[model samples]
Target chain A: MGTRQRIVVAGGSLAGHSAVTELVGLVPEAEIVWVTGEPHKTYSKPALSKEFMQARNELAELTLPDVAGDRPRGLRILRGRSCVSLDASGRAVTLDDGERIDFDQLLVATGAAARMPGMLRGVDGVFPLRTLDDAVAIRARLADRPKVAVVGGGLIGCELAASVRAFGLDVTIVERLDTLLDRPFGGALGSYFLDLHRANGVELVMGAMVERVALEEGRVAGVHLADGTEIAAGLVLVGAGSEPCTQWLDGSGLQVGDGVLCDAHLATSSPGIFAAGDVARWTNPIYGLRMRVEHWTNASAQGRAAARNMVALATGRQDLRKAFADVPYFWSDQYGQKIQMVGWHEGHDRVELDRSGDVPGPLARFYRNGRLIAAAGVNAPRVVMRLRRQIEDEARAAEAA
Target chain B: MKIIVDRQRCDGNGVCMGIAPEVFDVDDDLYLHVAETIPEDPELRARVRQSITSCPILALKLVEE
Candidate 1:
């Protein structure tokens, strides 16, 4: 037949792997190349925060199942090699080792990098939990039960703190925000996490900035807060946040805001090039805004959707292309409780908590213009599931209307 | 179809319970328990298979009898 289409996918996280899996299923004849910066195969990134800390056992425990066994015949995986630059017009990418790989279609799923505060750079006994190596190093460091200071009250920081505390280590969460998880769950639900952590014996330092990481003999001794308070610690974990890995595409003429901009179909500004996962800021028709979601479920769903769209555009079956419109869902496990959230409620005007009288579990629903936009719950999996289905049904009805 | 759960692999994430509440249950202690051994109904079988596929930890498996 005609020349085989070459598809190059950057990044080897869940999103990139999912895209490759989808492409192999959609177009078996196409040649696929997966370029990953890490040497290891795709593993569960979320497990690094959830399970890895508790048990420092084999890496296989956290590894992702072998989805590559069913890959297409012409698949090539380049591990430990990162895409350094992109040439959209020529449909080519330059790797870090000075090798150029050409592609008929490209998918950028570079994901994101952990945001480390400037003061903690190059300090000993300080780590940012992102990759497999980071997890292993942190686990090794915990063997001594050293006092640990977590420099954020977000999901990762809270989870890490709780897991470390389970090991009986003295842990303190230093947060700049007034309440934990406020950005996602707002004040009411954020307080729930606050109480959870407090009950678990994890100390919380609220609304205080870490002025600098105190160093002792080139190693971390503690942290000095902006309010002139010093907290003693032997180990520090920075989980401030993460930034989209889009530095490689700086010179490329793609629309780059906080992430590579894409339309509702997850297609980038340049034709035949698309982005997904945390690296893509795409228009969500359901939310009526451009957003970049870093949740695992959203990444997997977006990867598949982007792959389908890429296949349609490349094979000239544009009519078969579908819009990427999956509800964002993510769950965080901390202190034997499952905190789950579905959909977005960032701009919601009101929130209502439906709690069974004096019961431990409560379902919080966010409403925007009298419409249910999102729902979050603590230890309420069944209610969250029903609410998710209800939100999806409403969206479908709205679309039909 | 018979559903099997590897207790060693299950993280008690409750994803399966959300996907197939009838077949899977996650208690307050975060212990995931299978409500039925064999899904006699076709709809329940489909949901069990869906939960097996959706489980992030791959703790659930379907075995053909």
Candidate 2:
């Protein structure tokens, strides 16, 4: 056994790429192999939903760090290689190409795949956006000025529906819930957002269940609502939700719940192995809960934290510590209004609307559990900024006081 | 030196343009952009580097040449 360690990073996305960057800084002497399922260089996931939809070749503009400098001495980046399974007992991985690699430390940041519902199967032109390929396909369909139908009126779906309209394509959004952004935003804010989308020429069909998808010539032609009415669409994009990509670890003996279960340090039950990004089910001591976040902020920070801990384990360094709790912050842009959200406003007992700011702009709706738990705003970047710092500081003060 | 934006952390506030006018600007979608990478000019490089540090969202990073 040598002090020089080999670290294997599977899945090259935001979290995987961040781990590569931080590991190089943390363990400069260690050998790191970065494997990605995507053929091109690692890019931002958030852009795949919106900006890339609006422009061509925008994915090429999203390259990060460019860690593979001349010779690429410490890091070896392999594209188009997918890991089939992990052998925790042997600390080895079996690639889809039948290549075997052993590692002293393993970080699984495979993230999640866009979950396609079973009922929507055998329906052509009904797609879910996740990877660059998904974005490219959707972009091509929109270019034809097709009448598009989007299911799941959450952040991504709403943004895409709006983008399609901006590109001069007819758009309609079908949401199962009573309002748009049901889980993330409350009734008032969701209503405001729905109106905004409608004002911009997007048709909103709320509380509608998609019974089945209609296909013609092996391509999606329309979606049949539960009400027995068929809504025609040249293509259907179902952004219902996502599930963690943990099928590779099917019998690996790691504790698997909604995601790969990890302790406070983001470590898997197995030794010498850790997980981060959207796939890791992190336990938050601050809220006394365990959850998986698919946001970029969470993925980036968790990647860096996981890397530091990996280096600590490899070098036998005791000073490096882990365990992080962040006040969940996310942002979305639609109808030319920048919407920012801060904190977890789940199960709020009350909602306070502050319309003191400009009408239809710069409004803040606070969700309170006696005090304040979270806030959602429309065109209110200033309020969102202040609330983020305030909520974080308040959480710290509560811990101390 | 060069500046980097963590596209994840970036809220497209466009405040970076206010700090360093020569190097940074906001695109049509309100996202931040770097007009040029200061590869040779040390003086302009230092200012762009400083703006990266002062970015509120911690979205910017500086790469030294």
Q: For every candidate, how close is chain A to the native chain A in TM-score?
A: 0.96, 0.94
Q: Determine the backbone clash count of candidate 1.
A: 0
- Summarize candidate 2's per-residue lDDT along A1-401 as a digit string, tens digits: 46668899998987887778778767778889888878877776676676677773365556654653433567887788988899999898889899998888899999999888897765667778888788888887777788999999987798788778778788889999878977766555876887788889998899999998888888888999999989999989888889999999999888889899988888899988999999999886545468788877677667877888887777778666667676666677686687767767666677777777553364554555455667777665555656665776767776687
List the pairs of residues colliding in candidate 1. Answer: none
Query: Could you give the interface RMSD of each candidate, to one decimal?
Result: 2.5, 7.1
- Candidate 2's TM-score reads 0.86
A290-388 in candidate 1: lDDT tens per residue? 999987767767887899899999887886599887667888888878888988888889999877654347778988887788998877666676787
Which DockQ-derived CAPRI band holds candidate 1?
acceptable
Candidate that scores best on lDDT: 1
Misplaced by over 4 Å in model 1 are A70-72, A317-320, A358-360, B1-3, B12-54, B62-65
Best by TM-score: 1
Q: Candidate 2 - CAPRI tier?
A: incorrect
lDDT, model 2, position A247: 98
